[model samples]
Target: MRESKALQVLKGRHLRLEEPLLLSTVSGVASTKPALIRYFDQKISPIGIITTKSFQVTPNPGNREPVICETTKGNFGNSVGLRNPGMDQALAELRALRQEWKFRCLLNVSLSANSVEDFIMLVEVFSEVADILELNFSCPHAAEGYGASIGCSSEISSDYVRKIKEATKKSEVPLFVKLTPNVEDIGQVAKAVVDAGADGLVAINTVGPIVHEDPVSHTPILQNTIGGKGGCSGRWVHGKAVSCIKEIRMAVGDDVPLIGMGGVSTGEEAAEMVLCGADAVGIGSAFGTVSQKDWEPYLNSVLAEAEARLKPGKEYLGPKSETYLAEDRQMAYRKHTVTKIAYYGKDTIILTLDGSLPCKAGEFAFLWLPGIGEKPFSVAHNDPLTFVVKKRGPFTEALWLLSLGSDLYVRGIYGAQLENERTDKALLVAGGTGVAVLPALAQQLKEQGTEMTILVGTSESVAGKALLEDRLSGFGSFTCVADDGKNGRVLDLLNGLSLGPDQACYLVGPEIFMAIAAKKLILQGMEEEKIYLSMERMTLCGIGMCGECVCGDRLTCQWGSFMRYDYLKEHAPSMVGL
Candidate 1:
């Protein structure tokens, strides 16, 4: 019968909220414009505040893929390399969100600069539009001389915060410094920032630049090949967050507000943060469970539970401590025994595993061979976790020679999947091994009762033609164009087809080929939004955290593997070679 006490005043500003919960930066899910629009439109509950993904002055291409890996339940290790669309584009998107945002919003800004001027400039610019400014001083994955590089040094952290406060003096924007948990003493860092005029603090950014490896491959699972260290977040980092918040709260002595965030996934965790001296708790990663529609109910359940436990004048009890075992921190790469391997087409082979892995169409996994390393491949089939492999590099070449009963490590179900828009008809275009992702899409379309047509192109036709036909059997209408055709290019086949107003097209192949086909479809009067293409990039992390698979402003691992031509044209034209 009473309103939740989650709404509290910070720095003389009151955050009107339905509940106390705040969605932390879940990167691709919480930081993107499209994702935010959906969240606001759906009115997801406990929306005390929303924070954008950390952005810097310049566009960061990030690192190569295999950027993120789940070490255990609710634990993720990621080295995203601070990928963002730079200041100009970031400002434009922020302005757009300002116009539409009904809830309080904080812009999370990071700086990877040689001098403090860039940091000041960012603060000055963002202070004008954002309700609150979060200075990301603790991004462990940032390039050298940035993020944690700055935060770890008390003098540098103080100087940066001092300059930022001075820069925003005119705007009087509240500055919240986000600190790193990897430091020797986070409390000391917190004190330095607070002394330098930080209005608040976000305790414990991701912990550790941890590494994970594939046991079979005896190599790092991340595409960076070395398993470069990445920050750890989720359930595993919850204790670290609590300890950091406790220390900061002790250091700041209840004056500076501390926002505790790390691996918070439930209402109990939220309450635990409050008890640990957090003025407010930020929740992320947990929302990965359901769609935007379900967020309100999910948050309500979380808040209700928190409300019941966090009564007035509750005493602070220390968090329960636990030890993490080797298995707890390790990557979950399942060892699948290869049951079958057969040549599909020239240079192409289909590998069938002894057991199945749950996956969706368009999702991919890392295939690991000990001493040979691991690489990502689109799932050719789900039931038995099949992969259509091509001998493109050392990994694939090694995979080609793998005999029956050979052990391989497969981990994933990453990237966005092809969704049915309920269109009357759908056209699928595949070039080379891009055909591997098609069977799953065709099957989904068929189940949805959407008439489907597939046009596949290969450099050379061998048993591969028959192999493709067998995969698509009973799924859709199929056609093929090979180099042996009158024209050697896949684009030549698109000239004869017509896309109607009610039709949609999905393309996957070499970048140039897809770009040409997309251009052709658009020229034929197809709405750019109706045309989709799969982008191939060196994906380090299948999640958006690793900036390796960025296509212009979008992360191919998160925003797309399948993306709309119109959206790309407007936001990321470079992605489509426009």
Candidate 2:
């Protein structure tokens, strides 16, 4: 295959890439060992560079849960607090990745101390394995006197850059300084860093320490109680990033390479960044919005747009910001009104939406309640688009309180869907709210003329069984297992069950339960590949970007929410929870 034109010589180093689209400083997606392995192994997109999540000298636990919340007009507010596994763990992971990495990678490093010694220490350790070193002087959510605190002042930024440059002089890996836009004049900081021996610059980390609160609870939504505000990313920060790049380019006069990033989700946006004087564009939140499989298509679209504008005959004016915004708005989030709500039990409710979005049996959608926040839910039914929610946390509890006709925003249909395989017999096992996905899966299997036996394990009393039998009646043979003897535990029922060679199993429930069930089936001579398990994790974006849903190398939102038993056994053994 011919090499991509996205390749560019930066500071005498040939940065090879199929596209100028770089996975930006998304800590969740690009930081971890598993995430990086997934990126290089999948080769989903020939992205030129991948920057690891920002790390400090010591491990930072970061803020509490609900660290990320969707803002109005296609932005995401996150206060993850720069949580990273310290320098020692980070270097260890990078050293391993260096042996196998096929693409150029940058290590985004941060200093937690005011002393220049800590900065030098970080540089020396990471420079050995990093293809490029990116000094993160702009993380907004870092502890006091760190991150943007260092970048906001030109003198401080210059001093830090100079010290780092001196530290890495031996290795001489191209050093890029990431600037924070929260400064009074980003141009000054850019000029100072460039003059202080920086080879390149990544403009505009997230903007603002935006906050969100739960309306009913009268408390902050983030687990940090009253969350320290975090930077805003995604579409909202695009304009700020472009303006910063333009100013920085004007200040430095184009000699230094500039990597423009912030809310760059489309090809048009990438082109816009270039027009604003960026040599390359970085993508962060956009990746979170798409699945692992969609990475190539999404990135290619941006590359094609950038390439089209760079054509010899094409005279590139500037990107039409209005047009791009309009186009992005269409894809961001849409309003859906609740048409029906039925209580399955005291805690579980099935909501029917009036929206007509295309969705599959096992796929999920993100439900957004403006001030409340967004959460991913598997589509319970598709006719009118339904979501079955269990009252688990603040978000779900708020969702449960909503009455009919309540306005809500919905996005996605993301993740892989259950496959309709030709089997003589299929077993569907579910526990708790996991049964929500079974009705749809069962319906699909019934349509395919496959015999299915569904076993539901719930702790709820028989009265809590409300309408389940009615909903699943036509789908297949049904069995309910309550913890009480009225029924029985699913495992007890399974103990007596028999399986033929042609029998297949699909399981969705608690991690331990599924792991045990899979083990049991395997011992019963069921082929590992024939058994499928639906997984759940702290899925933030419902796409691969957030890294929250990552279970080993596989991103549950992209590679699965439903995974093959054998694949999990080999690739994500720890996730098996056996």
Candidate 3:
């Protein structure tokens, strides 16, 4: 077991690091796979599993694009109307995991219904197959009158919990009710769930359905048009998640297990969740943002750093700014490229500028748009440090107006480090603008004589093919997919490629595309350790302090933007962005 300063904070039921456990109730698919199991054992020990919602009885496709999005904050927004494979499939997956995994698995079954009976039926069906069942009365967007709509109401929350309590009378596994952060006072809701017999609580799911524009299309990014938009998360969401956890912890007292999530991407962040009242932490966006190959290392690094910081002699690296830059040679800039613009398609213009340092494939740099503010963008390449940007916000809009050679202020190689050292077989999955960083990664992989395959998914034909011809040309074996049948969906291309077990799959782009890919990989029986994916989120403060990026137990900006696909497949399935 790893040592942690947080060990002290973990007392009573809160202290459980038998292995590195994560309250991974956020993943949608790939819930129970060997790869996920391996990741938990290798990266985070003493693991727990949380499967995505399988409706009480039927299978359903959740939300559509703009199911998740990349805002200036990091990545947020998902309108996935509670899609799941239903309880039958969920139970089968659970039973399989219980029989196979060496560790004790906690299946956080997220369920929703229009009525308490719907919730009860769900409980009865899968209650015996898993360790824990989470009542997801708090989903921001659900089929009419379901999910958060009911969770927000104390009466509804109470009745639903009570019904499930009665239904699970023979089940020893505890029941955790996962709540939303949208309420003005979530304490009341927490009390209701507890009084109704919830054994534990997973405090604060994503806070909103905030929407953004497509700049060029002037249309909503999501296909659902008007559902709960995926909320922004990262350092920004920390205070809120903590506040909610603290309040709920206080309300329920210490007897009830309280798991903290949201904006937690590092061990320190997870420790904070513990301190704030979470017995365990849940990670979502962090795992979703990066490729699977990068996932375990990212979690291990976060936990390792957190453990180090908690030690007696360790020095805390507060924010990675003026302090670290001075002591670390890696942060210093080798050369400065003042405002330089490169045309990316017809609608997007990538601006490269000067700042703290150059960027690597998995690392991100910050762009300060003066009046519009600063934003973090993945370093597309280091040979020529670049940012693939869309003309969305005021700063970016103003940036578009600038001619080539215009001076642009840049800063940071902030966020988590990339596993540039890995020699694993690589599978790159990119969606829309996500293809930006692949060029550099592909280039390096090719240079190293590593075989690489790039799969790009998009909804448009022109955009899909353009990414392939213009940017991905230099990379080995590039394939593009368009949902509208523009060229071919990346999924089909992947089928043709015949991925092997040794290959590490990496994904970026829209959340759903990544989710589908991750799930597909898992179903294909790929090791989760070999699957990789990336997620975009609302990142602020660059460092881990801000809580805006927490998805279950991870923060995308600080802890990851790169991760193993299996890590995501096991936890936070819905938020995977597939």
Tens-digit per-residue lDDT, 1-578, candidate 1: 12112223543121223335444444433445533533433455465556666777888867654566675555776766776788888888767766764544444433345358887888788765665577777887777777888888889999988886776667555777888888888888899999998878886777877675544555564444234667777778898888888888888886566677888767678777777777677766554433333456666666665555676543323322121111232336778899987776678898989888666665677776654556778887788778888898777888898899988887665666665477889888888888888877787777778888888888776764675578775667777778775433767877867777789998988887788888888788878878888876766545443344555455555544777787778766766887
Q: Could you tell me the C-alpha RMSD of candidate 3 in Å? A: 11.4
Order candidates by TM-score, high to low. Answer: 2, 1, 3
Give the winner by TM-score: 1 or 3: 1
In candidate 2, position 192 carries an lDDT of 93
Window of ten residues with lowest summed lDDT in model 1 = 318-327
Residues 283-365 of candidate 2: C-alpha lDDT, one tens digit per residue: 77776665555566656666766656654454334443233232332124667889988877677888888967666566777
Best by lDDT: 2
Q: Rank the candidates by lDDT, best first.
A: 2, 1, 3
- Give the runs in model 1 whose Cα sits over 4 Å from its true position: 1-9, 12-29, 32-43, 99-104, 110-114, 213-227, 288-293, 312-331, 336-363, 368-376, 382-408, 414-429, 441-453, 459-464, 473-477, 483-578
